[model samples]
Target: MKKFMNEAGSLAADSLDGFVGAHDDLVAFGQDRKHVRRRVLSPGKVAIIAGGGAGHEPMHVGFIGKGMLDAACTGHVFTSPTPDQILGAIRETDNGAGVLLIVKNYDGDLMNFEMAAEMAVSDGGHRIETLIVNDDIAVERTARGTGRRGVAGTLVVEKIVGAAAEAGLDLFSLKAVGESAIAATRTMGVALKGATVPQTTRETFVLGETEMEVGVGIHGEPGRSRQDIADAATIASLICRQILDDLEPAQGQRILLFVNGLGATPPSELYLMFGLARRFFEAHGLVVCRKLVGTYATSLDMAGMSITVTLLDDASLGLWDAPVHSAALHW
Candidate 1:
């Protein structure tokens, strides 16, 4: 419940103002600050826009820059951006080449983006396509029948697709690239501690000091299971096994391994987890060609991390290596 801000009601907005100011050279706000957009866009290039809730810092917003999303529509903490907000982004970012929306597989996100895309096409006559990322291997179907929730694998999708878009790929071609990346990606997360939503001033979930939740969602949603806390090696083994079994990458397959901290985890621990995860992958006969480790996608101050594996081919590999300059990711 302890946070520095003007007020709980304005936490999301306040934080955004500071972020926009800090990275103004790279990004700017759309009308009414509905979205964060790249300061300079490559005219006629496919515009890549990704968005979702607000608490996952350096995600949709932090990723707005060269070789990545041209714009990002952000909502209140853990809330979906409204259709109007999304539509505005589409209108502003779309040049001749059209806009691609990268949305996570959450009910609110899916519905709102769909509404906006429909509006943009029907009203604005803008060509817009949507790519839904469902790489979280933790859940095949929610109680409401929603498929796998998008987790840290979202970064993989955005980066690869962004690079392709920057390379002048058309709308459908970029969509194809995004779909291929999603198909090759799988992720799972574990929570050592729960996150506290500023508005409610309460932790999204409670965990005993000795308990941990496996396969947790970014929104602090219930995970696959809760169990007594175990050592890092045990935890890494359990998570890597689940990911490899599901992804089923062929032996010697090249892959990009990402270890994303969920807001509160420290770099030291994240790196340790990465080492353990790499061992697991190498032991299984996979080649770790590209690797990223950091606090990329996060739940508001949640102390945990997620592991993502994307089977990589030559085309995807080059796209990943392509130059990118964003608030959160650059190479």
Candidate 2:
């Protein structure tokens, strides 16, 4: 509602323009104008392209750079990119080694990307594969029986898979790595305040001053439950427990812990949550092999955060630590 923009329907496009300009060092707007690709790409390495809607910053777009996605097709806020846009991304990023698409498990995303992949392969004569990330432990099915909704774990998929693609892995191997990453990951989020889309003056959802959604999705979707806001420790415990229940982490098992801000949550709060998460890990006898804390994936100005735990193996560990140069994450 209280956003700075030129117009309502044009927010996504205008914001993308700013995004493209700011990350000019690493990204360029595709000819189709609905996607982004790395400035420099390997001639014959497996190219990785990840995309979804626009509000989740430092996600598909922010992860476009060295050792990551070669292209990212962005839709409007919380919407799926069209098949034509996705096809354009496939064509542009496909090197001699082919291309891989990392899409969340949302129905629209799945359908659109699949259609685009088919179009690219049968019509464009390009080889393209798709990896669907469904690591949200919040729920197994929504009202539409669309299976699990993808959340922050999608970022984990991009990181490990991107590294493998950069290492010249074949298309099949790269897809396997992505699937493995998704299998090893689980995420849960809580929203203290709802977000307002740029097109409307109303918030996506209403929350009482002292109430919160215990397990929120990135698109302002309804979470599992709503309750009075609790302390950081309690909130962190609930999120960790929900994800760990699904993950079933073993004693002394290693994990890559990520505490992500949902746009409006501050670093101070996220670090506090991370501290509590670490305490919980210590109490559970789990070892955190790597730590990533920030707003890597975010809703549109939503005051919340998500916790993602990826049980890392030797291969994932090495790839997770691999060098990455991107807009949102770099190491």
Overall local distance difference test of candidate 1: 0.94
Model 2 alpha-carbon drift over 4 Å, by segment: 141-144
Taken over the whole model, the C-alpha lDDT of each candidate is 0.94, 0.89
Score every model by TM-score.
0.98, 0.97
Per-residue lDDT of 173-224 in model 2, one digit per residue for the tens?
9999998999999999999999898877678899999999988899998899
Residue pairs with colliding backbones in model 1 are none
How displaced is residue 137 in candidate 1, in Å? Answer: 0.8
Work out how many backbone clashes candidate 2 has: 0
Give lDDT tens digits, candidate 1, residues 1-331.
8878778778889889999999999999999999999998789898999999899998989989999899999899999999999999998899978999999999999999999999999998899889999999889755677789998999999999999998989999999999999999999999998999988889999999999999999999999999999999999999999999998889999999999999999999999999999999999999999999999999989999999999999999999999999999989
